[model samples]
Target chain A: MANIETSLKEAMTIDGAIGVALVDYTSGLTLGTLGGGTTMDMNIAAAGNTDVVRAKLRTLEMLGFSDGIEDILITLDSQYHLIRLLAGSQGLFLYLSLSKSRANLGLARHQLRKIEAELEI
Target chain B: MTSGSDPYQSVRDELAALRQQLTGVRGCVIAGVDGLLILHDSITGFEPHDVAALSAGAYGISRTTGSVLGQGAFSEVTIRSKDGYLAVYAVGELALLAVIGDSGSNIARLHLEARPVTQRLAEKLAIETSHPFG
Candidate 1:
């Protein structure tokens, strides 16, 4: 039961957070973003990642797969890119990036799941 | 080699070859940025005009998003469903390559295969657009 900015702030509290964005996949727009304004282009990341989510959903639909995506994890050389589509909110998603060396992967995922549940919009 | 007087022949041939090579591919279309159908070789039951319109709309949004964020140009955009994938690749400035492929398709491989064909089509379209009478 938290607003977008509050939810984003809570997300950054997780260990080794680089950035986080709340994006609308339908229009490829950022609802809110935090922690990377200094160095990261949050809007661009949000917009581009919409394709990633759209691609997965479209792929899943074509495969005739019934299950929905929980989250998508892309492991880069030094970072982990996590895309979590909201179960309750259609066309909305949370995108988070983490430093691989400092973040506990399992714990971060668990925390993200909790935050998603509590997110109001 | 001399070019065909019919401008669309090579594009059609390339599309047909793509369908044959990619076992999982269902259909494809090359459309202008304005959502106009330039050439299409989709299977029966699939509507290319609808796809052309949708792809153009999606691509337009992506490009606008990119510009607002200062990310420059977007090379491609992909959409997936339960049974397959749909992707649109930027072909020069005139057209886009939109494809529909099944779940079993190796997507990265598909992109690799599609790139060269996209380049050729782009070049041809660039020529045709610049010299519509010649």
Candidate 2:
């Protein structure tokens, strides 16, 4: 199993990855981050995603749904933002940004899931 | 306080109606952004004051999380457990509305029914805040 930094690094290795962050949603802080540049603002993006997760969670509860969210996807013109809440940690999540042109959505999601399962806090 | 003169009487009535409409609802508490209890019903077992304090506490971080992330405004938060659900919604600019429902209850229905009531309460709270002397 990979630790926090390793898990973040592993997430960066996926195809079309622009950046990845291990975030504590409760605090809106990133525990670890990798591969962000001038073109991509990791801080802003990662912090903003906590709300997306929050909204969906609220929606689920209001809808009376029993299932927990596996992943949330936001598609941009040039990018795909994927927010995955960890199965083990209730308020922690993995944020992965991908270049739509270079990444295969299916494969990237699969890899992220695999990494999430092996990730240790 | 006299019901005829009290602005909160309407809010209290709304809460009473909400309890009746939501099936298996455990209880509810409307709290201020600062964590003070404005109103409550049933919502037993849990301390009413604590529920208010915690709602404000959770809301602070949740609102910050929303603003910094560009998710617009923080609307509502829900924590579901084995027994049931605890849901909180932002009421206007001054308060929060929290509803507790059991496993057999439909949270969606509660939210649907409670939203209008929350809006009305928020309006009253807003009026009170704007005209404190009145």
Candidate 3:
């Protein structure tokens, strides 16, 4: 039953977590956000990531498969962007932006999962 | 709205049924290629419309990557998170089925259950488009 604000704060605590948001993949909207400043805009990041999610879903339909999205990861030169869909919550997702230099991919994924489990909405 | 005469009725019905079959899954949504919701079953706190849009966006990116790599087409895509996973499967050429769940969920089982539903929907769409009475 943890609120989104709590979740966002917890996500920031992860080593190297630069910013995080609970984004609506459908509308490309940031439902909640924390961290990220100056050079990074959580809203823009969420909107741009919408394309990433849409592209993967489209490719699957063209190929004629039956399945659903689990999570999406984009690795940049100096950063890592993670888009994780909320299980049982249709259009909600957690958009995590982390610095590659300081973030542990494995641990970040683990923490995201934990946060998802505890996330109330 | 034409009752039995509506060509998309059967297909829509099938999708609804598929939604039920996937009831145990977390954050699952059935949406059209345009990202419009066809059917969805999510936890109380989730928003189906938002997920559908994200699914559409993800599908779009995947298509571009496929073209760039010279891949023929994509059937499915999975993104693994630290604590869970997001999976999107194609149901015919115009629809997508997305699921978000814990890493511990039986992905193999989910895929198996969704396969027949996808195939059936594809066939139904093909028949409707090809037959006048369908």
Whole-model lDDT per candidate: 0.84, 0.81, 0.75
lDDT of 2 by residue, A35-89 (tens): 8778886766666676577678879999999899999988999999988889965
DockQ of each: 0.03, 0.02, 0.02
List the candidates ranked by DockQ, beginning with the highest: 1, 2, 3
**Chain A agreement with the truth for model 1, given as TM-score:** 0.95
What is candidate 1's lDDT per residue for A1-121, written digit by digit as tens?
Answer: 9988889999999999999999887656678989875777777678677778878988999999989899999999999989998996587889999999989999999999999999986
Instruction: List, residue by residue over B1-134, the lDDT tens digit for candidate 3.
Output: 22585556766565556545542356677777799886665444568888788788888888788889999676777666776656777878888877776644444445555677778867766676577653
Candidate 1: residue B132 lDDT (0-100): 50
Location of the lowest summed lDDT over 10 successive residues in candidate 3 chain A: A46-55
How high is each candidate's TM-score? 0.50, 0.49, 0.47
Query: Per-prediction RMSD in angstroms?
Result: 8.4, 10.3, 17.1
Which model scores highest in lDDT?
A: 1
| DockQ preference between candidates 1 and 2, better one | 1
Give the CA lDDT, 0 to 100, for residue A68 in model 3.
79
Q: How do the residues A14-117 of candidate 3 rate in per-residue lDDT, one tens digit apiece?
A: 99999999986654557798989888978767766765776677799898876878788889999998888888856778989899999999999999988987
Residue lDDT tens for model 2, B20-55: 875667788899889999878776689999999988
Task: List where candidate 1 sits over 4 angstroms from the true fold.
Answer: A1-121, B1-5
The segments of candidate 3 whose C-alpha lies over 4 angstroms from its true place after superposition are: B1-134
